[model samples]
Target: MTDNGPAGGMIGKVAVVTGGGGALGGATATLLAARGASVVVADWNLESAETRAKAIVAAGGTAVAVGGDVADDDAVERIFSTATEAFGGVDIFHNNAAAVHLARSDGPVADLTDEVWDGTMDIGLRGAFLCCRTVIPLMIARGGGAIVNTSSIQALIGDTWVPAYSAAKAGLLSLTRSIATQYGRQGIRCNAVCPGLIPGVRTEPDMLERILRRQPVGRSGRPEDIAEAVAFLASDAAGFITGQALVVDGGLTGHMPTYGDPVTSPLDAPAAR
Candidate 1:
């Protein structure tokens, strides 16, 4: 990193990361803490959040864990309260929490039930609504703040299983824009990162090899890949950018599928490390 590094202006800032218990969220929370931000790791799973918080603290970074459902307005308030009591006002917020049951009910919209649809929206859409509603004022009060929301590649595509997941993420993109436009004058900026297939590549490379070979980048995306994007969007570097949905899918969405897999593709010769 240069004198003005990747996390410029993040030092001493307070950040709240919803879903910090998960792979991408935990990685983002850790990265922010390492860059001199005090982070509150909020998650529905109390123990998961606590574990991540402990690891951050152990690594000489500042972090605390708050456990509750992000979809609950009361729980959302508690999250903000914890952030305030721990590190003053919120300066950076990463809305990354979500829920879905893909193995059981996620399918074509016609095949999906109320439970699957409602559950997905409750966390993905409603949860984002509550967090943004609560964080916007805090951000304004603090003079300025950055909000990085986790949208998905699913939102922009047609082929997919989780219909509710796609709809909720599409809603997230719209919500991101609304916040950015409405609060740009109030010193608040909001943006979303639409990450492609993620989370399993690290632990299930063998099983994911086929899908990994399809990415134009010649590899599967890592959680840190998304985390780094979140860090950039939440940093001073992106001060002038907002209301944008950045596609961080290693060019996976950049093709028309005619980049046909030749014999030289990663599938034929194991994906390059």
Candidate 2:
């Protein structure tokens, strides 16, 4: 067991992170553990989850690995049950699991299959719903807690491919607001972290290059970038923040859509007298 220190904002909190084995999720899980929160690293891949949990333990933090799919109701129960049994109850929940495989199968709405669409929504959106439903009562019982859903920049923009993924992420933002408004009176806060292209994690090389050019930062986002945002929102440091979608895309969505077009490039225009 890890001791709750005075300096950590998450001291004594218990957090459940779905997809905690992935790059972004693992980073968030590690950071949360470092901040004095006992973490439950739940993931569909048991070995991956164990690897993350062991790393935290080696670092003198408290954590456990649970193998399960967030979309399954039974698995969702097992996830929180592990948190409750191991650390008493949940004080934070990070809904970060996603159906990344959808990228291979996703296409324009006209060519999209039911299987692909269902797969995306089931894991991306429904999974979040299941987690929120399961953890809210536990959080309320503990007097309050934080929820940070992992949305995507696609949620706020139009894309030719991956229509289902985009829709699910957009749906998540709506759910975030609903949860915050309905449960804020009970001290339960919910929000989302919309990430831009993080190289090697989600975006393809060609797509990454195109998006990176449009991003004002001129670089792909790091897993730590999103992780830090999640940690802050999940901690008391962001106690006043709720029902909001914090976009961590390095200003990818803050500018005009035609920013990278050569014809519209201000840098290429003739200098004014």
Candidate 3:
């Protein structure tokens, strides 16, 4: 809720942000509102959504809250309905909801269960599909709009843990490309933001440290980092950009597997005479 200065780019535009109660989503919604967009903060937890919406309003921004399970078709419909009724129409959509808490149940193919896979895909992939399907036409009617899906670095790399989450995120990238290709002429732009280790949610300290050692930036990502990427992709500034996956993980995926390996590290080489 820090003062980020005057609002401008998003003036007169309306935005719908799923998972708005969470770290990354809340940050994105707040930024959009601060930039002058009326935002609908949707989340599975009604109270959390309302809290974010209320904060936006208190900060002199426009926002409203809607609570529902994004996995449900009816809930998705209701989310957009609230957007249309509250602000006339949506010009931006941030499809960010996902079952991150289910990571405990998600595992490699051998240990993964159908329930875990289904639950992960239900919210991460299917939910985004539903939102895009429902919003594309409305955006077409409004002349054009932007959509930024919250993907993950896991989508672009191999990971032993959270197989379902990785798969779902990968699916979002494909979905992003598909939407962009199909709707470009119609003025709708779709992109995905892939975040690295944003630790606030449920990341373990030891695991985070391990990842950080390999990260080129040598640090963990912040929710605001992803939020900034989302806002840009959803703004007029990114008009020329579409069907892209913007990685906001501080160069986590920009290095080789041996980056942190002492045996191959340049820093460990003997100094020349």
Number of colliding residue pairs in model 1: 0
After superposition, the stretches of candidate 1 with alpha carbons farther than 4 Å from their true spots are: 1-4, 100-104, 201-207, 263-273
**Candidate 3 on 1-273: residue-level lDDT in tens?**
333333237888999999999999999999998888899999999999999999999999999999999889999999999999999988999999999889988887998899999999999999999999999998999999999999999999998899899999999999999999999999999999999989975788899988888888976788888888898888888889999999988887897788887888877889878
lDDT, model 2:
0.91
TM-score of 2: 0.95
Q: On residues 137-157, what C-alpha lDDT tens digit does candidate 1 reach at each position?
A: 999999989999999999999
Ranking by TM-score: 3, 2, 1
Model 3, which residues run further than 4 Å from truth? 1-8, 271-273
Give the number of the best model, judged by TM-score: 3
Cα lDDT tens digits for candidate 2, 99-182? 986788998898999999999999999999999999999999999999999999999989788899999999999999999999
Q: Score residue 205 of candidate 1 by CA lDDT.
A: 57
What's the C-alpha lDDT at position 210 in model 3?
Answer: 86
Q: What is the TM-score of each candidate against the true structure?
A: 0.91, 0.95, 0.95
Ranking by lDDT: 3, 2, 1
Candidate 3 has its poorest 10 consecutive residues by lDDT at 1-10
Which lDDT values do the candidates have, in the order given?
A: 0.88, 0.91, 0.91
